[model samples]
Structure formats: structure tokens, C-alpha cells
Target: MVTGPAPTAARRSVEEVRERVAAVPDPELPVIGLGDLGVVRSVATGADGVIEVEITPTYLGCPGMAAITSAVRDVLTACGHPDGRVRQVLSPPWTTDRITPEGRRTLLAHGIAPPVSPAPDGPVAVEVGGVPCPHCGSRATRPHSPFGPSRCQSMLWCTACREPFPHLTAL
Candidate 1:
């Protein structure tokens, strides 16, 4: 395997570091980059020449955190920024609203229904009604289960397509 360049007094610019880290793919969802998934909150290079990356978990206790963190670090090292550090930022807990429109489209293309935002007025259940089916693009869907293979997703069944699909829950 090719190794990263040796550490130097000046490394890549802050923006470059940010862009590289942002492109890191989600371990669980390889099709979506961390930036598109809304997990990578920020990236900055300190005066001391250390690159710091902040990320938020899709939810607390997400098992994928370890893998995501590892991937970020790997990217930094591969890009010749071995001194980079990854931190978790929970202050402004992550929400599905942060997912970009492109990310949503990617999810649908890969057979997963993008999350549907809950009502803005008040608290809502995790399983939002009328979730469209990725397979058939029909809104006549019902909750198959509150939980899918992963904690971040819920199973949904489309009446129109008569197929089951996974819906990323809106948190």
C-alpha cells in the first residue's frame, strides 16, 4: 500500500482538509459520504498544525460511530495529515433535516426511502405516515416495523408496490 507523505511544517490548507474529510464515506452506508449524511459537522486546522474534525452521530449509542471515526482518521493519515483528530459533537444533536437533497436522492436510488420530516408544530412519532416507496415511488405505505436491521431505519411496506422497504427515521 502507498504511504502518506511525511509530516511537514505546513500541510494541506484547512479547506482542503475539510473537503477530504467530508468525502469520507459512511461505513454502514457506503453510497453516502459523511458530509452528505450530515454527520460531519466541521473541520479545521489549528495554528499548531493539527487538523480537527467534528462529527455528530445519527443518534446516541450508534454502533457505527467507531467505524466512522476510524474511517475519518484513515482518510487524514492517507492524505498526509497523521496528526488529525476526530471528535464527537453532540451539542446540536444531529437531525435528518441536515441530510442534503442529493443524499436523499442517493438513498432512494439504492432502495432505501429517504426520511420524511415530521410535523414542525409538535412532537411526532418516528414512523412518519405516507413514506414513499423507493421501489415503486408510491406513498401508500405502512410501517412494517419500528426498527429495521439497524437502529436508524424502520421497515415500511408499500401497498401500491406490495414491497417492503427501509425508511431512515427522522430524528
Candidate 2:
């Protein structure tokens, strides 16, 4: 009887690598996957079986980049791609617009307000106005601080709920 070769770890495809990497969570935002956050740009596997992943950070000098990179490597290695490497792409830069709808929902559910989308006509005009409060869904929120615990987040206080929440800054 003739039988085909058995599937092996070495036979892992680029798609498989991508799927595995996609499941990797963001270091700072554990609730959202890197894929949902639009951080993972592309995944490619070389003939030598080395997998390379391209990623774009939410902003330059984002402290979580190093952690995110390490997590990607760990995930890839565990998925049988021990030679996987993550490459950061900063040419085009990252925008809040890149965030997936599911990611936005996740952020909101996590009590962090997602960045407002840029106006269709042009870029959103930055105004000193109220940002919707994630806790009470009130537009009576004010910026408590221009900065939050993380670089990409802004601290906001909701007048309705009298609570402070993080708002994802628009890039």
C-alpha cells in the first residue's frame, strides 16, 4: 500500500503562521489581539522555513513595542516557527483608522473609549470639547489629563458618571 508523506511542523504554511500570530494579544491591551488592533501588517515564510512578520506600532516610541515583539516571537516559536522574526514598519506610520471595528468594540467594552474616526471630508478637527464617556455613554466628558497611563491613551472624566476613564488618542 502506498501512503502520502505525513504532515509535519516544517510543512506549516504562511497562513498558519499568520493565524497563530494573529491570535497574539497586544502587550498593553490584553483584551484585543494584534490582528484586531491592526498591528500585524503581513506574515511571510521563507524557503528556509523562517517566518517574518511585519508590524506597525500605534505610535513611535510606544513602550509596548518591545513587549509586543517578544510576544510575537514566543507565539511563533510555540507554533513550530522557531526562526520567526518580527520587523517593525514605520514608513507609513500607524493611524487610529487602521483599528478594526471589532477592536474598537473591544476597547469600548473594556471601558476605554476608542478614537473618533476622521471626518469623511477631511481630517477631524481637534476641538476642546467633550469626549463620550465609556462608563455612562455621556458626551459630557472632559479631558482630565492630556496623558493617561499609556502614551496612546488620554485620561478623561465623565461628568455624568463622575468617573475617570481612558480614551484612545487619535493619530
Candidate 3:
């Protein structure tokens, strides 16, 4: 039998953490996975496999923190890791850009248009120039109110499609 050197404690490779966190499903959207939502920001390992992770939520007020944390822990535990630390950061805020292209496609396929291209360069309206409805691909959508489904999204209805859709509000 051949044996390899024992792995020493150090910040695990970003790739390792990604593979772990990527599988961690979002409590709200179990099908969409956390990695798809672009929530898994930074993952680092310390002595004793003390993993630290930073995540950004789809919405600042999105009420999935506790469940999300538990989900992350579950993935870690499954990976033979016992101690994992997860943290959520609001700085820089969560934006569509963080979301992977695959995630966006997934969201759209699910009938929710991921915010319109991200807020133009700067100092722009959250939903100006109109947001396209991921449902029917119509730009003729209007905000029903300041808020719609969640803080991250506003209510928008498509006149052409005659369907209500969620528009991700750019922060």
C-alpha cells in the first residue's frame, strides 16, 4: 500500500470551496442552487477545517438566511468537513452580475427575467428604459409598485403578454 503526505491545515483551494458551495442549494429556490444565484462569494479554510464563506443575497431583505446557512453546513458536512463557518455580507450589494450566465438562463427559463443588463454605468434609475419580461420577451412591462415579489424584484406586467412578471430591481 502506498501512502501520501498528510494534508496540512491551510485555506482550502478556492476551487474546493466552490465545488462545495456550488452544490449547496438555496433554501428558497432549491432547484436554482446557491452557485447559480451568485451568492457564494468567497470561501476560505482555516486551521482545523474552519471554513469561512461570504455570500450576497438576491435581496437585502430576502428571508432565507438561516435556512441558507443550514444548507451550506449540510454540504460541508457531506464533504467530510465537520466545522464550517458561513457569513453574509451586504457590502457592494448583490447584483445580477454576480449571477452566472448559467444562473441567468436558469432564472429566465423559470420565467423570471434577471434584472435588465445591470444598472447602466452609474446614477441611473433602477428600472428605466423598461425591463423585459422573461416570460414573453416583451419590453412593454411596467412596475406595478415600488416593490413586487421581493426587495430584489419589483412587480412588472407585460401588456403584450398580459402576464405579470418580476423585475429584478438594480440597487
Candidate 2 segments whose C-alpha is farther than 4 A from its true place: 1-11, 47-49, 120-129
lDDT of 2 by residue, 61-100 (tens): 9899999899888777766777788999997998888889
- Residue-pair clashes per prediction, in order, are 0, 0, 0
The regions of model 3 sitting more than 4 angstroms off are 1-17, 47-49, 59-61, 118-129
> Which sections of candidate 1 miss by over 4 Å?
1-10, 118-129
| Weakest 10 consecutive residues of candidate 3 by summed lDDT | 6-15
Q: RMSD for all candidates, in order, please.
A: 4.3, 4.9, 5.7
Q: What is the C-alpha lDDT of each candidate?
A: 0.86, 0.86, 0.73
Arrange candidates by TM-score, highest first: which order?
1, 2, 3
TM per model?
0.85, 0.84, 0.75
* Sliding window of 10 residues with minimal summed lDDT for model 2: 5-14
